[model samples]
Target: MDPHDRYTQNNFWQSSQAANAALTGCYAVLRYSGVYGGAATPLWEETASPNAYNYSNSDGWNSIAEGLQSSTTGGIISSRWANCYEGIGRCNYFLANVDRVISIDEATRTRMKGEAYFLRALFYFLLENYWGDVPLILDPPDPSTQSNLPRTSRQQIIEQILKDLDSATLVLPLKYGSSDLGRATKGAAMALKARVLLFEASPLFNTNNDKNKWKLAADAAKAVIDISSSAGYGLYPDYRSLFLPENENNKEVIFDVQFIYPQEGNSFDLICGQYNSNAPLLDLVLSYEMKNGLPITDPSSGYRPDSPYLNRDPRLYATIVYPGEVWVSGSNKVTVTSSWFPITGYAMQKLSVYNSATKPPVKASDIKDGQSYINYIVIRYADVLLMYAEAQNEFIGPDPSVYDAVNQIRARVGMPNVAPGLTQDSMRQVIRHERRIEFAGEGLYYNDIRRWKIAELVMNSPIYTWKHTLIETRRFNPNRDYWWPIPQTQLDLNHNLVQNPGY
Candidate 1:
C-alpha cells in the first residue's frame, strides 16, 4: 500500500479527525486567488469601480473598468466563478460524508455540519452577487447528471442561502475558544444574512420599490445589532490600528479570512504598497469630508484646495498614502516623484504592517511578496450598523434609530453627528456617502454603486491622478455591464450555459 495514499474515498470519512480535515478543506477554498484569498484579489475589485484604478490589464479589472470585458475576460471573471463552485463542491462532499463519522460527538458533528452549511452559503452568495444566476449544485458532483445543469434563478438561490444561514445560526457557537478563533460563528452567520437581505432589497434586485423588502432587511440587520454585546461585537476604537495584524479577531470583526506568515501568507504589502497595483483614484480622495464633517466643497468646511490633505477626515489620512504624507516613519515623507508609486499618485495604507512605530521599522526593501499575513475582514460590526441605518432609512425615512446608528459610527472616529432633521432623500445621500468614505479601499464600493444603480453615472466618467491629470475614461453599460458575462470557457464546456447580454 502506498503510504501517501493511506486512505481511499471509502475510508476517508470514518473518523472524527477525517471529518474535521474535510470541513477544513471547504474553508481552504476561500483562500484561492479567485475568492477573497490574497490581498490583491479583494483590493483589486475596487478597480472595477471609480474608487481605484489598476494600471495594468493583466488582472482583467482594468479591462472591465474600461468597458472592454467580454466572455473571454479571463482573470477575475473566470477564476471567481470556478473557485466559488470549487468551494461548493468541497462543502457538498463534506456534508454528504461527515455523518458517517460515528466517533464524533453529536454536538461536535452538529457544529461541523453548521460550518459546512455556512461555507456553502457563502460560496453561493458570491455567485449570486457576481453572476446573478448560476448552476445550483448542492450535491457531490456526478459528471453524468450534473455536467449539463442549467442556471437557477438568483431568487431561488437566495432562499436556499437564507435557509442555510438559519441552520448555521442554530448550531454555530457565539464564540469559539482561542484555538479555533477564526472558524465560522453564530454571529458571523447572522451578519452574513443581514448583508444578503440588504442586497436583495436594494434597487438592483427589488426593482418595484418594495418597502416590505427594505423592512425585512432592516429587521435582519437590527437582529445582529441587538445581539452585538452578547456576541462580543463592536467597533474597534482606533481606525488605523484596526487593520494591523495584532488587532485580528477584534470586537469589530464579525467574520474574517485568516492568514499567517510562513505557513500561509499574502502579497498585500508588496502589491498594494510597492507596486501600487490598486491606486486610489482622485475621485475617491475628494469624497472624504473635512474634519468638521462637512463636504470639502462647502465654503465653511475649511478645506483648502492648495493644502488639500490638511484638516481632512482622519480616516483619509489613515487609509491612503498621498503625496508629501509621512509614510513609514514620521520623517519619511512620500514625495511627488517617488518611483514606488507612479500610477495614480496615491497608494493604499490600510492592511499593511510596515510603519515606523514598530520595534524594528519595516523599510521598503524589507517588504516581500506572499509574506504579509494580515487577516482580511469580510464583515464587521460597523458594516452591520451601516446596513441597518440604510435599510431603516429607506423603510421609514430617517427615524431616531437611524440617527443613533449612523451617529455611533461617526462618534467612533471623532466626527460630528449627522445633521438633525434631514429629509429622507437627503439622509439617503448621507448614508451612501458615509459608506463610501468608511469603506474606502476595503473593496465594498463596487457592489454599492451597482446595487444603487448609479454605476453608469459614476463609472462613465474620467479617472484622474491627484494632480488632476486624466488617467483614463471608464465606461459602464446600463443594459449589460451590470452583470458580467459568463466566462466563454464555461460556455464551451456546457452548451446549456448562456452568456449574459451585451457580451
Candidate 2:
C-alpha cells in the first residue's frame, strides 16, 4: 500500500474521503517517524547539548550547535525545512480541494477546513521559530507563480498564521472522544493561538513592546485559561508517565504526533542516544520547587545537593539523573552519574523506558524496542499552563494566579508553595526558569530563548563547557550564528531567495 498515495478513503464530507487522509498526511511529517526519518531525533539533542552530542553517528547533533562547516546535522535541518514546506503544499492542496467532499455537512466541512488551516499555520510557525525569515508560500501556486516568488517577511508569515488559527477557532469542537484522540480540537487551536500570540508579544517578534501585542497575547491566553480550568485538559499524576509508552493516549496531551513501532516509529531513540549524552543542564534540574513552593536556594528546604533525592520533588527523580540513579536494564544497572558531580554533570533521563517488569525489556538486538513506543508530544497541557503564566505576567503584572499557576506545577513535586508578594518581573523570571527546568531536553530551549529575545543573554555565555574535559565547549556567535545560513544548496538553486542578516 502506498502511504503516499494522494487519497485512500472517502469521508462523509469529501466527495472522495481519500483526499482528506492524503491531506492529513501533510501534518504527519512532524512526527518522529515519517519523511525525515530517524535523523530528526537530532533536534532534541541539538537543542540541549553541543560538546556532549559527539559520539558514533551522533556528530550531526553536535555539529548543529558546534557550528560544523558542513555537516549531516546541517543537512537534516535543511531537508526538514524543505519537507515541512512540502507539507504546507499538501495542506494547501486540501484547502484547495476539500470542497470535493460533496455529501459532507456544512459543519464537518468547516471543521475539516479549519484543521487544514491549523496545520498550515503550525508548519509556518516551526519555520519562523527556526530560520526567522523563511519564505511563506500560501496556496498551490501555478508554475508561473513559482519562479517569481521570493522570501516573505516574518511579519507577513505571522499574519497568515494568525488567520489560520482564527479560522480553526470557529469550527472545532471543544473536545474529542477517545477514537478521535489525536485529532485537533478547539482547545488545541486555542492553546496554539495563545502560544503564538505570546510568542508574538515576546521580545523576539514584538521587539519594541508595542503595548497592543502584549494585550492581545494576554487576551488570547485568558480565553484559553477561562476554558482550560473547566476543560478536560490538564497535568498527569506522574510526570515520568508523560513519556512512557503506557501513557500513549493520556489526557494531558493536547496533541501528539502519533507513531507506531517499526512501521511509523523508526529508531528515534536508538539513533539519538547512540553515543551523544543528551544532558539536561543543572539549572533545569533544580528549577522544580520544593513541594513547599520554595526554591532549592531556600535554606529551609534542607536540600542537600549531596543527597538531592531524599526529599526533593518526585519529578526530579522522574525527569533527571543524579549520581546513583538506577533504571532497569535487562540484568544490568542503569546507573546515573555519581552525585559527587555538580548539577549540570547529571544527565537527562526523562525519556528512559527501561523497566522489564511491566513492559518488554530492551533487546540488545532491536534498539528501538529498548525505547518507548509512546507517541511524541507535539503539544501538551503543561505548555498551555506556561503560556498562560507568561502572557498573564506580561499583561496583568504577575497577578496571584501567576503564583497559582506556578504552584500547581510545584505542587505535583511536593515542594513548598511559592511566596506571594512577588513582582511581575520577579515572577516572570521564575516562570522562565521553571519552564527551562520542566521542558528541558524536549526540543524547547532554543526556541524558548529566541522567543524571549534573550538568546544573547543565555547563549552568549559559556553554553556547554564540559567541566571535565576540553573535548566539548562552545561559544554562541550571534552575528553569523543566530540562524543557519540558508542551506548552501538552496542558495545555489534558488537565486530568488535571500539569506538572513549576517549569515
RMSD (Cα, Å) for all candidates, in order, is 1.9, 4.5
lDDT of each: 0.87, 0.65
User: How close is every model to the real structure, measured as TM-score?
Assistant: 0.96, 0.85
How many steric overlaps are in each model, in order?
Answer: 0, 23
Across residues 6-122, which tens digit of lDDT does each residue of candidate 1 receive? 887777877888998988888888773548766336888888889899897646989989889998878888888888998899999988888888999999999999998999999
Alpha-carbon shift of residue 288 in model 2 (angstroms): 5.3
Best by lDDT: 1
Residue 422 in model 2: shift from native, Å? 1.1
| After superposition, candidate 1 runs with Cα above 4 Å error | 1-4, 32-34, 328-339, 356-364
Candidate 1 overall Cα lDDT vs. reference? 0.87
